[model samples]
Target: MGALDVSKIVQGRQGWRLITCIWLHAGVVHLLINVLCLLFIGIRLEQEFGFVRIGLVYLISGFGGSLMSALFIRSSISVGASGALFGLIGSMLSELITNWSLYANKVAALLTLVFVIVVNLALGILPRVDNFAHIGGLISGFLLGFVVFIRPQFAWINQKRVAPGQETAPVKRKHKTYQYILWLAAVVLLIVGFTVAIVLLFRGYNANDHCSWCHYLSCVPTKKWKCNSSPQTCTVMQQPNTLDLTCDGTGTHHSYSIAGATQDQISQLCNSLCS
Candidate 1:
């Protein structure tokens, strides 16, 4: 098909942009890296669990990453399948943890994979990669995999006698109370984690420094007491009056002022009055 716009995919008026954005990416390199990762990890998972389960994991993990990004990174546009790929990796790690017996050498393989990913994460700190999304996806995938794949049950148990001559001890079933506790803990952790992510995202996007009033005028410290109403009506305030004033970037020209106060002083006064 044709190229897709990530902003369009994720820019819903209400909030559904989170779902659509995961499928879109910025460029060829971006698309290739994610696709390769997915192909390697996702295909294997699908083969084991069937397509439906794999699809569910991908969707959930992708959405989790998008939600986190939307809440945290407001200025820059983000588009990629890296989050979903990371989630798949997390799932693979979980599978290794849960079924160590069936999958021989899984522990070693997982450790290697973990090492590679950690190094990549460290590299991500240098520049443009959205490390937060990668982390969110990985954690979400890991949690989902643990819940779905590792439910407490003894899949292997020997109860019947192999032959009449030989008697064997009945295999005892291990209590799954700990597993249940772990499941509960995982659920609680996921909820708390997502909540914290959302809060931080919102806080970061809507920082006090990005206030409309503060950025509108470009007044310096020395000319703090001047108020400019418009291009024509630049006025210097005799006293510090808490009124909104618009100023050009330089102190030479004040765009306009609401009262006889500097923009900073006006903002403070407004906050105090509102409070």
Candidate 2:
């Protein structure tokens, strides 16, 4: 029930849709894709980092995705967990980097992961896909991974394993200096990014106003297909015993003979006419 409706969010102040929309999907195909991806990517991360960190990455990343989508795509409704899925992908990349020494076949793993990320992002440019969400989730999760996934240096870990009271040189720091620097920088960036995005969103700033070419990142027109940015609407005219409907997108008209019809019925009829 919680598909993202931009008007409800901006005009009606229903900000909670940003979170609720993540758990909703447009159709069975959409739900299956998200669920399968979640199982494939989430299981390993949850096993390694536990539920808390993974859950945080999921929810925050989903919100980040919704915020970006709201800013750019004011028309139409959006629903799905693609943003959260991208966040997991982003976190995997950052985790590999932050814990580079702990992993084997570093170069090979990095290449494979990079390839996968690039391919998925490329797919976002297609029509009806929200690339902005993918991008926002990725950035949020990448920064978060550095902060939450920092591992202790091997020397520090070995030092802890030493027998009690045994003579051992002190491993001055648990984590490398670079890790600390990255963690701090990532935290600061995350705060600043979220602050700016929220402020812009509440102020009713449309990202499309500033970036003319940004829409191409979400969809590109081709000879066989075209992108539709306008929201679906219908103009209704009612008489005592008949109703007339006109689709705003296509200007197609339909007439129904009925004594009276509720709003939901009218909406369903309009949708059918538009379709």
Candidate 3:
């Protein structure tokens, strides 16, 4: 039931929408895409690390995505699991980095992952897509990977394989020192990032005001398609049998017969004219 509505979040203080929105989608196609992506990327993660950690990454990354979209695009509604899906992708990237020593052909794997991430992010720049959410989710999941996906070193694995009571030296720490450092740094960064973003969102801070070019990340104009991100505003004059609409932004005027027309119908007509 929850969709990311900026007014509801800021005015009504419905912060839970940030988490709940991830469960909703704009349409069937949106839902199907996310499901297939989750199947492709998430099942393997669950098998490798189990569901609990991956689920945490999904939910928290979704919240981070919602917070970011709210800050940048405050005029529209957003609903989808793409952000959570992007989180899984980000987690895969970080998982590879954290477990670098475990895999052969590391360079090829790294290059392939980078290519996939870049292509997906490039798609987000199209109109009506929420790239802010994608970026935010990617960052959150990337940091979470360091914290939750830390693997035991090969030395630790070898030590564990030794027979009981035949140990020559003491058992080494399970994780490397660098892993602990990365884990701590990631934890601090996630905490700080979430806190700051949440505070700014509740305060109704529009990120566009600070970064003039940030909107281009979500949409770019092209010859084939027009990218209009601004909201439409219109004034209406209604009579018993007719209605007149005037777009405030563009000063375009149109009229339509409203005989026996419902208010919802008139509103929809006005929106279409304005858009």
Model 3 lDDT, residue 58, Cα: 96
Q: What tens-digit string does per-residue lDDT give for candidate 3 at 20-123?
A: 99999888999999999999999999999999999999999898889888988777789998888888888888888888888898999999989998999999
Candidate achieving higher TM-score, 1 or 3: 3
Question: Candidate 2 lDDT, tens digit per residue, 178-253?
Answer: 8888899999999999999988988887776566567677767666655664555788998899998876543456
Give the worst 10-residue stretch by lDDT in candidate 1.
246-255
Better of 1 and 2 by lDDT: 2
Instruction: Name model 3 segments beyond 4 Å from true.
Output: 165-171, 229-275
lDDT of 3 at 201: 87
**Predicted model with the maximum lDDT:** 2
Between prediction 1 and prediction 3, the one with superior lDDT is: 3
Candidate 3 structure, TM-score to reference: 0.82
Global Cα RMSD, each model: 11.0, 10.2, 9.3
